[model samples]
Target: MTDCIVVGGGLIGMLSARMLHDQGLDVTLLDRQEPGQEASWAGGGILSPLYPWRFPDPVTHLASLTQAAFPSFADELLQETGEDPQWTQNGLLVLDPGQWDVAQAWARRWPDVQLEALDQPAVHGCEPALAEGFDQGVWMPRVAQVRNPRLMRALQHSLVRRGVDIRPRTPVSGFRVRSGRVTGVITEQGELLAERVVVAGGAWTGGLLLSLGAPPIEPVRGQMILFRGPPGLLSRMVLNDDQYIIPRRDGHVLAGSSLERVGFDKSITEAAAQTFREAAARLVPALADLPIEKHWAGLRPGSPQGIPYIGPHPEVEGLFVNAGHYRNGVVMSIGACRLLTDLIMGHAPICDPSPYRIDRADFSVRRSNAN
Candidate 1:
């Protein structure tokens, strides 16, 4: 049997495959659609969670654990693939007055991150595009963003060049388990056996895991809108009312996003576009009058408390999972992939593995061990 078969080709899956392959293991990545076209491409690519303090410790811990590694990771991809992921260290500015106190308190807890409290004048000074009347804000100087599409392409290319087998349009329906071990997968083409399997299938992960009676790992759709503007139109990503405006180096700015739990649907709505436009304009008045260049939606793997389940499937010996990252999949990929690899290879994990285990819910797949 092959060493490992990774089911799902999103960022999480690809990164998982890449990390394992680097360990001298044979790895194959399979995806339902073209890899990286799903949530990985649709996300705004903010390196940090919006209002990071609002999330629980697990979410913040995973994110913070891998915070310092992102820059070199991106550079490694670009140098090896010759594709620019546009990893920019553009600071994150939060304009929500209500969260300032809590955010500042959270910042103090983590001294590695620098968060500055800005008054009304300082807020405008930081990002002059604002329309005014903003009294309080918090600025995270270390936050960065990557162009999603570019990053996806870079990662895809990097994996191919690194000798990882990435197969798109390969829908995995379920796993082939035997005697308390995952033997392989029930793929669309046919049965493909492997020594181990990692199911990182974002929104669709739950559906595939359901055959084995896994817990709910549903989809949360987030809608996004974009605006074309000059290079300096918006400097430093601005977050307000849970919506963020991210600027690309090439004079294009992206404003997003609304969270919706609408099942497997990826439909874009005008209501969401208007909502994003209004939010973006609140931070930059010109965005209100600027044309919305694009609108799209992607299904994030929604989980309880925005925490992803990483590690073994508990019952199935060789079956592992690293899905359900919700909105933080792109940013969380670093720590989650490393952590998943460590657990899979029976090595010391990069961090505590208790919080992300599938068995944390105390549920079984009914078909714990198979015939």
Candidate 2:
């Protein structure tokens, strides 16, 4: 029996397995498909939340705790796997007009988070690639981004190097429970016993645990469009409203995304691609001329108010969860993984785990039968 079995291979699950293994626990990670090719790879890899002040306190708190830790984490991965995640502090330019005051207030409240106000010329100065805008903007100079695909590759290699048994193409049917505690997981291959099981299955988490009664987690599809521009064509991450553009170290510029609660559909739509094109042109006129290189969509584990449930289930003694991070999965995984490990090890937590606890009376999951 493995010490812990992580039932997903995206950013959250892989990280959870690694954290568990670091504590001298035997960890096995199972995935239905290729690891990290889902939302973890499809995301723009922006290290900070988009218009973060709008989110709830829990969202902001977890995001805040993980922001500064990303660079070193990426570096550690590079050192271990020889793959550069391309962590760049290119900064984020928020052109959401009239929200500067709110952003400034948030900056003042969170001294660690640095935000600066910019006028029209200042905005132009910050991003010459942007179109002529007659308004104000908020600049987060400390915000960073990574090449998510590379980051995923590095993580896979790192996990393998540390002796994690990664079983891909192994679909999980359900969980096995006995005496109010999980004994193992029921997979297509066979039953694998574990001391603990963490359901970090992202959007599929709800469906996987439905028979076992999980929280309200559903698949929220988000579509993204990528543009291949010159290396210096776009220097920073430009955000105007919900649509934002991220430029990578290479010549590729990534623009995304839409929150469509259309089941587990991963289909690409021309309409959504056109919408991103319009957003790109609106933000940076130069993008209007460049053809879209790729368009794809991935499902996010949408939760209540975008706050991910990240603790043990109420009724299950040996079960835990670390999913439901709608758009902030990439930004919040560091803190979430650390918190999950802390809970599993029964160590002093990095932050108050109440906000993310899933066992609240109204949201508890109780299963009497041992399947």
Candidate 3:
């Protein structure tokens, strides 16, 4: 029996498995498809929250913890894999603070976070290409970004190098439960018993839950477009009302992300692409003529309350959940992994995991009664 069986090899799954293995646990990771191709890779790689106030307290705490982990985590990944994840501390600019007051309010709620106001010339000084804006914006100096694809590949390689039983293309059919405790997981090939299981299956988590007689986790579709623009189009990440621009070192710009309620449809629509293009051009007019590099979509697992399920279930022992990160899966992986690790190891977590427990009384999985 493997010490731990981690389902879904995305950022959360991979990190959980790695942390467990580092602690001398025999860990195995199972995934339906190649590990990072899901929401983890599909993310824009912005390491900070787009706005502080949009997230609730739990999310704010999680994001704050994860942001602190990026610098060291990026360095560690590079040292282990001999590849720089291209993490840049370029800070984020809230283009219009007046319109961003809701976010400002959220930031104010959290005294632990640092938010500074930036003047027009300061924003221009940081990112020269930003179009002349009406007023000042908020500057999150510690905000950063990463080349997510590079980080994904590096993490996969790093995990493999550390002797993790990384199994790709392994589809888990369901969980094997008896007397309220999970025995193991049943896969398409065969059954593998483990002492514990952690489900980190990003968008597909809801379906996995259904197989085990659990509640629903809806998938929200997010579409984004990539652009190959001239180097130095925007120095730091620029946010304007509904859109933002993230420039990479290699002259590739990641202009994106529209929140759509289309369930599981990964197809890129003309409307979504135009929406991103128009938004990008509004922020940086030069993007109006930039070559469109790629257009794609991915599903983000969203819970009813927007907070992820990151602890053990009340109905099932030895089974833990770590999904429902929504738009912040990449940003929250560090804390999510830490919280899951603590729950599995029976140690006190750095922060209370009660709010994010899988079986919160109010959000418990409803059972069917024979009428």
Candidate 4:
């Protein structure tokens, strides 16, 4: 029998499957569609949260652990799969001078987080393409980003090479529960028997868990636009207000995004595209002249207070959950995978798992049968 059956083949699910397999567990990963084509591929790949201080301790803690593990994780992927995710350490520039004090406080709270106040000239020196009027900003030197699509591809390749049973287009319809223990997963194709099952479904996690009596996970659609520009036009990722501009190594400048609670609709609207375009132009005036290469949207699995459910189900034996990461799925994947793996293997976790426990009061499922 498969030791573990991981539902949802996004970054979290794929990584969790790989981690479980590495620990000598026979693993099978199931996805509704092709793996890594959802929010995991659509993200901007920022290694840290947009405003680290704004989030609670749980979010920041997971992000910190993931950030520290990313370098080695990327290195290992490169060594194994010979595919580079283009992990770049160009840092992030926060243009909201109004939050300078708050950002400074965050830096003080975290000794490892390096935040520096930049004058107008310094801002220009870092990203000359930025529009004028940005007099001062916060520069986080430790911030980094990875190409999301490439990272997903590398993980998929690595997982396959590691002998993981990855099943794309396999939609999990329900769970086989005997007494209180989950015996296996009921997919569209057939029953997948396993000793343990993990629900890592992204935006669809809520629906998948509803029958099993779990918390509701909603889909928050985020629209993004890609601008093709000359290389070296924008060197660092720039965040102004809620929008951000990410510059890739290949002269593809990604400007996004609009957080709309529009369910699982991935359709891009003209208004959203225009909004992204304007935001990008504001960040870097030269981007106004650049051609928009693409426009798309992805559904982020949002949760209350932005904390993901990352532990075993309270009442369901042999069932675990790692979904509802919202926008930080890419950034928090490594730490989350580690935590879930440790829990499944009965090993002491590298970090405290209390905050991410599924049984937390705030994370309780709303369904009547959830208890």
Per-model TM-score, in order, reads: 0.96, 0.97, 0.94, 0.97
Judged by lDDT relative to the true structure, which candidate is superior, 1 or 4? 4
What is the Å distance of residue 200 in model 3 from its true position? 0.8
The TM-score measured for candidate 2 stands at 0.97
lDDT for each candidate structure? 0.87, 0.89, 0.82, 0.89
Using lDDT as the yardstick, the better of models 1 and 3 is: 1
Where model 1 places Cα greater than 4 Å from the true spot, the runs are 360-371
* Model 4: residues with Cα > 4 Å off, grouped in runs: 360-365, 369-371
How many clashing residue pairs are found in candidate 1? 0
User: What lDDT does candidate 1 reach at residue 216?
Assistant: 60
Give candidate 2's total backbone clashes: 0
- lDDT by residue (4-103, candidate 1, tens digit) is 9999988999989999999888999999989999999999999998889989888888898667788999999989999998889989998887777888
Candidate 3 lDDT over 1-371, as tens digits, reads 98889999988899999988987899999999899888888888888666657667788788878988889999999999998889998878777757446655766777666677777787677677766763687777778899878989999999989999988999999998888899889998899999888888887886786645454567788888899977766678878775888989878888888888888888889998998999988778788899898999888887765688888866788888888888888788898888888878878896889778765443344343211
Error of 4 at 58 (Å): 0.5
Any idea what lDDT model 2 has?
0.89
Better of 1 and 4 by TM-score: 4
The runs of at least 3 residues in candidate 3 whose Cα sits more than 4 Å from the true structure, single-residue gaps closed, are: 97-105, 108-112, 360-371
